[model samples]
Target: MAVLTERPAAPVRRRDRGARTLVNRFLGYAVLVFFALVFLYPFVIQLGNSLKTQEGAAANPLSPFPDPLTFAGFERIFAGTNFPLWLGNSLLVTVLVTLGRVFFDSLAGYALARLRFRGRAGLFAAVIAVMAVPGVVLLIPKFLVLNQLGIYNSYAGLIVPLIADAAGVFIMKQFFESIPVSVEEAARIDGASVFRTFWSVVLPMARPALITLTILSFQGSWNEFPHSLVSVQDPHLFTLPRGLADLVSGSLGKGTQYPLKLGAALLATIPVAVLFMIFQRYFVRGANEGADKG
Candidate 1:
């Protein structure tokens, strides 16, 4: 008699469980949608206002539609400013910095990950420790070193210091260690030099990690501002971020020129946007591999 009653209760319990799961899933989606809107709303407003006239933007600051669309702000950005020169300088610095970081960081990472040096463990620990130090604390020390090295206020000062990053070295080392050791040993047995093996055999296999490193280096160098502010005082050497900062800081005179400011900012973000869009697949793969390796 008890078994016959319990069978009926089993169906009721499953129905209740299914209802609870459905409610939880609905709540989860609602939370996700809410947060997405919170983050996306500002970008929508920025785009909308960039096309608006100055008077329209000022009067209806929160409005998402331009009262009367105008391209004068963009016109001024190209015609009335040093934005082109800044863009050129930014491109030059970003390219060099990205290349240097990819090469130097990968070499150091490979050495740390594979080479049997006397103090390899200690050196890697030191690299990890350096990453822990706040970037702000290094500004004064870095400035003093650049001054001493006679590279202050030059392109060399800006480019050289940013070439190698401890976090980047750490990322490369982690990914390199995750690779199969047998592959490297086969190259060694075939009489390949360590550099030759690393350059030819190992590097090609590290495409995901290399792509990850390249994007990071490009983004870091492209959006860099504080380093530029401290390293070079000359307007001619200013990168896009530095120039954008100058534009925002009362450079265009009184009143909020929202259209011009937003337009400039939008232009500054395009390269990074394009880069992420093109390489998003590799980035996702690298992230998954990193998680597995971790």
Candidate 2:
């Protein structure tokens, strides 16, 4: 019998495979870098324009370098516009909405997850249906309801309607279900009431989900514009988004006012960016956990 030997061509095949992988990886990285620059280019322009003089910003709107840097835009933001008032309203609405959503959504989620009740499944299905409904579709109904309730054009309208969202409830319920029922059983055996079990035992263990909810709620409320448009026509009650809209619609004197507009938008984005950065890991982990449970 002839002794069989591994083909020397095997090494050449291996080298070919290695070369293909290297090429693919380089191409992948190049693609990623290209998209990253594309996505980030507008933000770079925004920042640069915000620092430029009005004339320079109007002239070089697409440029990422300011010909003559100035703080006049930001200064005008505080001194000229109603930015301070808008900022305060935004902060207040965001805080209240975030807190209310966290508390109410968690409670609703726990009830849905652990409680036995008539029509529980139906209620959850309804929540799912609500989630499916486009938010804009509800705008007219929401406006009517707020008007009927005599809360329109008031902080109550702005804050109360957003306190609990179907998505938050869905997220919390999924996360709660992921916790073994045995844990709640243990708490029950120790004579913990339903509220006690949920509040102390379950809620404490639900830090990740809560953080995720809080961040979402804060961001949503902070960036809310349509609701504000329908809820409050009063300039004093205007949030950052509504105020920005007004600014864009020529609330300030004529000309693009690119520097001032971009500056205000930049400032509006900072809070959400900071919050996301701080809780990014927690948010991702919570979202993954909730998704897995679902």
Candidate 3:
């Protein structure tokens, strides 16, 4: 019989390395928790102050609770201004814009990624250049375009321009590139057209990427203020940001009503915050998608 000698010493190196890794992971989590609180505490303060009265808020700006909690702020928000209307308009615009972007962006992205069409490179280059243009600088230029198109001061002006974004297209294109070409080839072998393949097979596989794009579009259009400011002028046509700006700028007329202001801001934040909480994982993936594409 061959003598089976025990391996003298399975090197204990792996065991030592794993212990070090566990310790490092623990420390990393501790650091992350610390920073999370640092960033999140202000929102906590805002929520608390929003419940206080004007005097209470002014007296204790940093307090997270009011001595005598009041709904005066909320009542005022409902009664004193057109808060409900603004909220409704914001919702309508955001939903339409998000849906439009998800469709248009993915369509364009698929074409760029899979179609060997004329001017494909040039079109993508133009998209990159468009994305480089600063949004603030486009205020006057966008206004001019809207006026020229006869959509200014209308809902069309507000919602149409936001439907297609270069960055969103680029994001989708990069994601499509990360997928293997064999999948598309297989679909083609089955005699499926490009759109049919993309809609049936590819898009379902791209659920994670789609969710990320959806969340980004929702947050971006919901929080957009400058675009709304320049797009429409009529109070009745105003989105939440436009109405909110009008509310703060002498429209409310007398005192500095911090509670009411904070209340409106807090309410404005809730939808996106809820969406962020629910789709937190998708958001994380989306943020990292760019790195993966690179």
Q: TM-score order of candidates, best first?
A: 2, 1, 3
What candidate 3 gets wrong by more than 4 Å, as runs, is 1-37, 253-255, 288-294
lDDT of 3 by residue, 82-112 (tens): 8999998999999999999999999999899
Q: Quote each prediction's TM-score.
A: 0.89, 0.91, 0.85
Q: With candidate 1 superimposed using the best TM-score fit, by how many Å does residue 280's alpha carbon deviate from the native?
A: 3.7
How close to the true structure is residue 11 of candidate 1, measured as C-alpha lDDT?
86
Model 2, 1-294: lDDT tens digits are 223435767777777889999999999999999999999899899999999998898787898898888999999999989999999999999999999999999999999998999999999999887877777878899999999999999999989999998989999998899888888899999999999999889999998789888887887789888999899988999999999999998567567788999999999999988887888886676567547534
TM-score of 2: 0.91
Instruction: Give the per-residue lDDT digits (tens) of candidate 1, residues 63-153.
Output: 8898898888889899988999999999999999999999999999999999999999999999888877878888888899999999999
In terms of TM-score, the best-performing candidate is: 2
Clashing pairs counted in every model: 0, 0, 0
Q: What is candidate 1's local distance difference test score?
A: 0.89
RMSD of each: 3.9, 3.9, 5.2
Sorting all predicted structures by lDDT, with the top scorer first, yields 2, 1, 3
What does the lDDT read for residue 183 in candidate 1?
Answer: 93
